[model samples]
Target: MYLTVFYALSFCACWRKMYFYKLNMAVRIMTETLIRNHLSHFEVAIAGCGGLGSNAAVALARSGIGKLFMVDFDRVELSNLNRQYFFYDQIGQYKAHALADNIHRIDKSIGLRTSIVKLDETSVTQLFATVDLVIEAFDQAAEKQMLLETMLVNFPEKPLIMGNGMAGFGKFELIKQQQWDKQVYICGDFTNEISEDNPPLAPRVGIVANMQANLALDLILKMRK
Candidate 1:
């Protein structure tokens, strides 16, 4: 009974501040003890670091996820300047590397790994073994489909989250997710409606990405019965 009371206090005080290298061994130990199945041991992978993916990564980082693995091969263009706040003067660099640096810079204690390669059959297999969750941020249908199919077949047990539909014709779903037998959660743009335009708008992307982030965290929390 006394141990339980002490455990409660450990989290309230020191654990909240532990993200940015702020915790000592005692606090980390006690806090980890209090939490259940924390994301500390598992790494979440975000594929496609464009606007939607970028925003989702930031939200997840702030949500106290212990480790993140971001993958993107494209470099920032002047066009990407509008939505990707995660992109800065560090233009021309690969998106994965730039975003990874930004995340680690924002919270030095957060474990962020990166892969600057386009998602493909070979790479998908290579990366899935290292990931506990997958977030699909690719804009193209083909890429999204490939990413989904690969993860489903290879790492069927890993939770996969994806985002689409942030623009054009106007079907805004505040949140949409799923748990396939393999634990796939498609976060945004589940509509069959195509607006002749892809990559939705800034607001739509942000909303869906936010939902994706929430869904990812919920999956991690496993609070849903």
Candidate 2:
């Protein structure tokens, strides 16, 4: 595995390949240029690749985080035109698939993978074991809960970073999902109390998405040191 040539992981290659990630030399050079020293050693997975998830993907890839696995079920739509960077040509493409392709196009050097499947408690829990950490960026509360519940129960040790209160002018928080311990980080308006309920969405989403990327980068930095 090329990761063996660079990153050493608890999990090894799923299969052997001719060229790692199918990336060319130019991609390898550019990918390494933007990656920080601390992030060069590890991989981080993003489980939701919609508004927040998609933006976070760009941030992480630009920063040169080694690998990413984006997961989403829905196709891009006219509604996603506002904030997402995908093209009008990609209207029918799944968010996860689009993000994966975008990330690869952004930096083929990074080992990027994706699953275009709606996440269930079953698949997510099973998938969590293969990752170092998960960035949770679901648009729906129920889907968010599905990922959170599974990670909290079965992969408690894996860091689960999530966004909260990123809509209706609420604040943003990148919280660590823990079973027995709960710590919240708020970036916008947590005062409404109603923010604790309902779905999140906009500038707040932007705020939270950047924060989540920073949090993931921060964790990767700490792990490297």
What lDDT would each prediction earn against the true structure? 0.74, 0.68
Show pairs that collide, candidate 1.
166-200, 167-200
Compared to the true structure, candidate 2 yields what TM-score? 0.71
lDDT (C-alpha) at residue 207 in model 1: 79
List model 2 lDDT by residue over 15-99, tens digit each: 3332555654424433344446557667777877877788887898889787788888789997786667577888999888887
Tell me, by lDDT, which candidate is best.
1
TM-score of every candidate relative to the true structure: 0.75, 0.71
Return the lDDT, model 2, position 189.
Answer: 42
The candidate that wins on TM-score is 1
Expressed as tens digits, the lDDT of each residue in 102-220 for candidate 1 is 88877788888888888898899998686777888887789988988887888887788877556653566444566555587776656643454554566767777888887887677
lDDT score, residue 116, model 2?
Answer: 73
- RMSD for each model, in Å, please? 8.9, 13.6
